[model samples]
Target: MTRWVGPWLLLTCVFLLMVGNVDPWNVLVGAGVAAALLRWSGRWLMDGRPPGKLGPRRVWGFGVLALAVLADVVRGTWRMMHVILGPSPGAKQGVVEVPLGERTEGGARVSALVASMAPGSVLLDIDWERRVMRFHMVDASRADEFRADMERFYRERQRAVFP
Candidate 1:
């Protein structure tokens, strides 16, 4: 029963997103589709893994991460605006390779996601074997700062939520 919650909520979200309504008929159809999809894909998705539970600590950690991301978004937006509207449009642009360090696969994925959420940076590639993520940044002159900030974020923010 616990295993069903994640898939059911995912399917419900997708159904609502696609159909854009919650009429009774639509809900019934969504439930039927969700059930069929769950039955068909449950084995592959579950993969004999136990369901994950979020305790208070994890919840608090997630909240902290969310706030940090929001702050990063605002700061990135302001910096991007300056770069765009400034006298010089040709700001230093390059890709920075950030070592994944001891981050788990899930933690690495979340790290990439959070890095991409910033306005001027995008996740270009992830090398699992090398355990590195490549990000293209608009202001690559601050590569060292960027790398340090990413390391801190992964170590401090993402580790608790995803590790």
Candidate 2:
């Protein structure tokens, strides 16, 4: 399932995005072309491209993560505005690492984007071996609190999305 669905979806998206056609008819045609090419030719199946076995729970889990990101984005935007308008420079920023699990590529990307967008944080690097993400935050004193918040947030919000 992983092999089939991931690549199939990727093909659909890349083709739809790159074909650069806005009309519905054009998009349908482009999708048809992409599907034909992908299903008939793509030759990596023998060596790699294992099928991804995403189940209902996995899709449901991602929906939760998506909502969390949306809420975080809104909250972060307002917080950033306050920091900018308030009579103070941004707080003392330092990098902090967050331990993560084997989340999907979309999950990883969203996590990075949301972390960067949140009020006082920005993604610095991802330590895959450590299964953690390094983020620069506005305040250093709150590192423990920040880490705790992230850990809690992911535990509650990500289980469904990436499960």
Candidate 3:
């Protein structure tokens, strides 16, 4: 049965939002416009099928990251100054290859974000085929220890938010 349902509902919303005038003439005009749009949509877009449910928690994840990045920026500035000027705390400098997860895109982003935000670590590159993130970290005398620390930090904070 061809009846005015979805398009009229949408047009009602639009007309009410645009102009509070509710009269027969306005209703007729709005219905005409809405029906034209519905016809166009039927031809060009999906045939009135509802879209998939989008994830709502993505914004909250972003909020969590905004705060974390702010803290990291301030702390990193201080740490960088210390590393450059203050007495040596035995900051290690080398390429520490850390094995990554199978989730290529997410794992790479997490590794880069965490490494760049941490005190003295920078993600140099990520090898997708090898599933490893090559990073440059400071203040670690051992590569294994540094990789463990990175993995632990991600599990504690990043995983909680992103995963």
Candidate maximizing TM-score: 1
Per-residue lDDT of model 1, residues 1-163, tens digit only: 8979888878977997799999988888888878876764465466664224678988899999999999999989998998888887646888999999998766776788788998989888789989899999998888899889999988888788876
Q: Pick the winner on TM-score between candidates 1 and 3.
A: 1
**In candidate 3, what are the lDDT values of residues 1-163, reduced to their tens digit?**
2555865678766975687787888887877867765653453233544222236565565567667667767876786677778576545566778878533355456557666776677777778778888877675456687677567656655554554
Give all TM-scores, in the order shown. 0.69, 0.56, 0.50
lDDT value, residue 34 of candidate 2: 64
lDDT of each: 0.84, 0.67, 0.64
Candidate 3, position 103, lDDT: 34
lDDT of 2 by residue, 88-154 (tens): 7565667888767656544554466567767788777777777788888776557798777676666
Among these predictions, the greatest lDDT belongs to 1
As for candidate 2, its clashing pairs are 1-51, 1-52, 2-51, 2-52, 3-50, 3-51, 3-52, 61-160, 61-161, 62-161
For all predictions, the C-alpha RMSD in Å is 7.2, 8.8, 15.8
